[model samples]
Target: MSSLVFDRALYRRRLGRALAAGYPDFLLARCAGDLEERLSAVLRRFGLAADLGSALPLAAPALRGKAEAVLRLAENPDAGGGSAADLIGDLEALPFAAASLDLAASLLSLHAVNDLPGALVQIRRSLRPDGLFIGCLLAGQSLTELRQVLLSAEVEATGGASPRVAPFADLRDLGSLLQRAGFALPVVDSESVTVRYGDLFALLRDLRAMGWANALLERSRKPLRRSVLLRAAELYAERFSDPDGRLRATFEIVWLSGWAPHESQQKPLRPGSAKARLADALGVPEIGTGEKPGGEKTGGEGER
Candidate 1:
């Protein structure tokens, strides 16, 4: 079986179409706002930073005074900007020499990557020593209400369901992925944003405009039955409607930051090398290595 999750080519085409039509930038704007705040907190400036495959042209504006140059990279010529990207490339294979970039920032990208682990490793490798990487992706129950209603409606109508939504990574898993990718000082955190819409169709329209429609490899080729769609809308209204009759949709944005390993960065102390015991710090009784929590030694049960 193919391990693929997203149809990258199809997604690029859809993204292009959305961009040409002017994708609603509310979400992208929100991400960019957060990015600005995070970037502002950092003390140093960057020589060159790449916006790797963000759906919108944001990095240059966000890094106006921080970075000397911003390289906008995308899968196609007209992606991530008006006329063309500074560099065209795919996340599966980044086009950068090892330890080349001073910083790498991607906004609202990376969720659709098939080989996320490999891509992360490549990002880490492309960064110069102590280079910073900061990005955000959709994760942890994003669009869960839409997912549930659609699946339930389909199963009810056709007696079988299809993959209509992409699976999101858990926060813990992404944190571990940074460590696995050899990123130092890794930080992973999530935020939830809820948007209200008049109805399911309104939400769907927004999603379509955002190029977030179903592009799953296992997605059903046939269009969703009108009956199923209507039923789903009904279910959504019934289950997720607010007091004012608007439907609610949740978007979970996960922000991740890490640095390329360097000698100046902080390191964890080895086990048994702590200068002070945790118990001492906490003013609690210390337990010996072989003793039980209750201060009982091994073989006590046998004696009893």
Candidate 2:
């Protein structure tokens, strides 16, 4: 697997801060906490505490029979003694046996991964039959207004197009990816959250703290000009500000759920149960007949 184009260390630090902010009503917030708190929540939600520690090799039991496990492929030299399995490696190339895990999860991750499909495939491979995988990703519609302003301002100030932000998969495309990755009974949905900021800079700050910076393949060599930035800020405020005079930043959260294949759930469709042909139901003449509804035999030239 290729290394992510974005700065991974910087991203992790930003994500840590964002998670620590504890934004209410956000799905990511629910899973952000110390290992014990996070594990307890997961256990309570799934209602599977018994034998959870044993079932998960790298897990530790916490309050209410909750457990936490951190599996990494490579060992971190800096990491101290802990139960957390330091399997530090790429998610796209997991070092685990096939069908070993019951559940897999990623929180505010995978967006920066270069090979998203490959990473998903690896996750699927690690799960047992009927296993579950849940994750969140930043989609195409997120930060739409900011992107437009940046592009327009860059072109106007620089007299050329600078590197644009990375392309994100739309909802439709994400759904197709789930199916293509061999997840059965796949379901995909999205939620657009509007975060209001006093100004454009505040929004950018939050975005940076959330580990979401422009990771264009071809980044600009020169520093951004103050004039260009000011113009961009003005454009952003004028175009995307709400009635309250606060700039609105949209973050589209995509929720994906799917189950692995199971024989007990498989069933063939009933024969001859499908809908009738459209031509037959509408009483329309068949194309090869070359005749009108009035029963006139049109010539070959007329048919053309």
Candidate 3:
């Protein structure tokens, strides 16, 4: 509904280079591995599986031998080359027919989607009944120290700051979105990864190599002032560094799972329809109506 925060085109271009380079994507690779491990635990067969927009080259590798066939969808066609993905497509608009896919996953992706809800709905539509979707993305808490230091430095230098860090989806919003997207039994959880860097500049280099540099549409057009950058680095070391002068950076990864609605799936009973009472179920003494649990009548003003 609001204006786009992330510049998808810029993101794609950066991601393309990251994919071509031999530089290792430690965070994305780790997340992909963890996602695949969880998918394997499901022990379900997937006739048609898709890895939705994962930047890591290992996305399809993780799904190998688990799915009958896997396709890696990438926003940039160049990023998909030499990979196991048979087709390259946009993350916001999946190029698949309804009820075609049995499983889908997006590792360290979807955080940059301008229309996440729409993308999720498309993923649900592409899956058949009882289809499973597992995904992991960077949450709001990721890069807390860097964000803070950058903001503080900029504000102090120019008396103002521009949008530098993109907003992230939290667990609650993600779970609600899955339900809104027609997913059943939706679940959301998160894990924190703390990486220590020798300095803030080293961390920035890693982020650039991972294609995680700021791509906010509303970002400042002008380059960041050198003074601000130096001050930010100073503040970072002062506030977030640990002993031995290594700076701590937090990356919060949120994992979500949902299944396409099916008739055979478990459903909750309607309100006031349950046959058992809470007191009886817990083996507690049953209090009569209008009376307290201690056998005292709760009538009159005392009830108020």
Candidate 4:
């Protein structure tokens, strides 16, 4: 996988260009707001925390007074303005000491990591026992319409299509990753944001500005042809436009929270150790599988 590593150098360059261009803030603003909302629900006080991969400068302010102090850690130092990020580090190779941080927060950045499982393991190791980790990432279903349109346009215009969008992790994959990384009480949830655009160009601009364009390792090196680009725009408008002729773009943000293993944290019950049956809790009569409620055999009229 190292041989096919993501072009982080190119990714940084695009992000830098986007920041200099004064690109749109619609997505980043929304992500920051979502992160703030999640941060508000965390009642426990943290002695020290790290905000990793923050696309904006909102993490510190959102976590102010919530944590004793927060040190910003970002992959792109220039992506944020006036941020006190003490370290510029990569997700796959976190620079923090093991078991040093009380909490860690990542804002819409983990999805781009080439070694997601390895990154999660690094995060797990960085936290102290029972330390909390909460983050959000763009899910696999995000921007489905744009991806479909772009592929169709390329295939029709050039007789073949290339990978134009990086693959994102789904909910199941994310939950399993946390567990595999040894996090306890892992929680995964998703929130979908639908934004209307004046046209395809508007959506593209937002993506570029957010520093989230096609950076796939297997992506085509050849520049997109003008004909294929125009076709994609037309298809996007034709297929995904609302009644007002604006394009609909979906951004499914998956939020995940987990805690490092600790003896004090809650643990699941062992198999077959429950004191009460599920049926009893629901106030329903217990019946074995293939048996009726009245203890009769199956294939009866009441079965269906």
Candidate 5:
């Protein structure tokens, strides 16, 4: 029962290529800055912070001010991180000991994880009590324009289509994952950023440089037809172009923040423990479950 969604080894190779290509930093920079701001808002100093699977030095540098020590973990040994990485490790399988870190942050990663919930559980287990975890990844709606055009174009050109992009998690599903992974006070949000490109080819170049190419285990091994690509570009320019003629490519960044559970963290009230009745807040009569409009119980007589 292999539940893997991505080819980890292939993705690592791609990540290595991205580093060699001088990976674009705009999205990483944005996410890293946001991670720092969110961590800063906590006001508590962290003794140790780890940047998990970010594949770069972005989060580590930003975390230095808030933590006494920061660990930069890279996905590939030859990722050219040089002094940037303290260790090379896998995000799916963290190498840290239990309760070792006071904070952990990942930027623009996690979307490629084969078992995201399991990875999150490991992240929680590695954190000290009340330790914070902040991360951002591409949401399901990321690259909507590219996804649509590619699928439509492929179908039109070849009479069928295969996955050309990886499937990303939804915001609500991510929030639920946090809770299921034993994270306390989980918070998830999404911000959509639309980037303009001269055309689909320009966008494809950026995606390749980002190491965000299709890594799904279920992806087709066959090369995309040149005709399909040409059709996709044409459709992209036709459907997604602005008045100025630049094509729009949306990237929805989903931010997830949570803390390791501790006694001090707020807890949900137990069922049937509310001190006030619903009627009191709504200024209306409260009807019992399965009761009639005249206050009659479904299996009993009406109250006098």
Candidate 6:
């Protein structure tokens, strides 16, 4: 097995800082609340309840109410005691029993999980037949411009590449994993969001506050030099800043939704359908039995 890439302890610390800095409150007031409203509208279009808040009164109740029961596996226990309940555990190994849940939802959490596939499989195992699973994760394409600028600056200053940033899943690979984990009707899509920053340091600060810090599998042994940091900032501004001089951080958010198999699901094509011979269809020769062209073996008697 590959080594875990995400440090949960570090992630929790960063998340705590973000929460303390009122990031969550801002998200709820500015964006998450609107998103929840939009989700509720969509659900209502499908004849589901619009009063999702009453059912699951979390920050984003629409997303929460979609799940029969929600569990958030964090390294630390949740302090908020409102609508959405939380659990302190590991995603790779959920505490629920098999077929115990109807739906599972995760938001901006799986990107930091090391065993992403394992966690998906674990979640699948906890779901009942025809259960739904939905989540959003960061993709590898995120922050491409920033990475390029940082790399160029690092080489100019330190005569080598700097340490790697965090690893994010590609959308295609994530879809394949859903199928590999026995999910049916998997769908994966991505959207990009651009955040403007005054400077590179501000961008890094936002990332840190969002609990998205570097957790490279192989880190540099030596400490970063002051020159490298200075050069990196300058390069970042020159390369990544817009005409207005605002730095931009791009994030590609991949959404995945899939369903657990059920007895009522339609069956896929069978292997035998591809093996049927044209001659057999034309009534010229036996098919799939190794018979001769004229219906008799020219070489020897049948082994049977």
- Cα-based TM-score, every candidate: 0.92, 0.69, 0.92, 0.92, 0.89, 0.74
lDDT (Cα, tens digit) per residue for candidate 1, span 1-304: 9999999999888887888888788888999889989999999999889888898886668776578888888876657446468888898899999998989998887998899999999999999999999999999989999999999999999899999989999999999999999999999999999999999999999988878889999999999999999999999999999999999999999999999999999999898797887898999999987788998787635642
Query: Any idea what lDDT model 5 has?
Result: 0.88
Between candidates 2 and 6, which one is better according to lDDT?
Answer: 6
Error of 6 at 240 (Å): 2.0
Off by over 4 Å in 3: 80-84, 287-292, 296-304
Better of 4 and 5 by TM-score: 4
The 10-residue segment with the lowest total lDDT in model 6: 47-56
Model 2 residue runs over 4 Å out of place are 1-27, 30-86, 266-304
Pick by TM-score: 2 or 3, better one: 3
- Identify the candidate with maximal lDDT: 1
TM-score of decoy 5? 0.89
Which residue pairs clash in candidate 2?
Answer: 72-87, 72-88, 73-87, 73-88, 74-87, 74-88
Return the TM-score for candidate 4, rounded to 2 decimals: 0.92
Q: Candidate 6: which stretches are off by over 4 Å?
A: 24-60, 64-72, 78-85, 221-223, 267-304
lDDT of 6 by residue, 170-197 (tens): 8889989999999988888887878788
Model 4 agreement with the true structure over 80-190: per-residue lDDT tens digits: 664456888888899999999999988777887778899999999999998999888888689999899999999998899989977778889999999999999999999
Clashing pairs in 1: none
Clash number for every model? 0, 6, 0, 0, 0, 0
Residue 41 lDDT in candidate 5: 82
lDDT of 4: 0.83
Clashes of 1: 0
- Residue-level lDDT tens digits of model 3 in 141-199: 99988889999999999999998888888879998999999999999999999999998
Predicted structure 5: clash tally: 0
Q: Tens digits of per-residue lDDT for model 5 on 118-223?
A: 9999999999999999999998699888899999999888788889888889889999999999999999999998889998999999999988888888889999
Task: List candidate 5 stretches off by more than 4 Å.
Answer: 80-82, 271-304
Model 1 local distance difference test score: 0.90
- List ranges where model 1 is wrong by over 4 Å: 80-83, 277-304
What is the Cα-based lDDT of residue 56 in candidate 5? 65
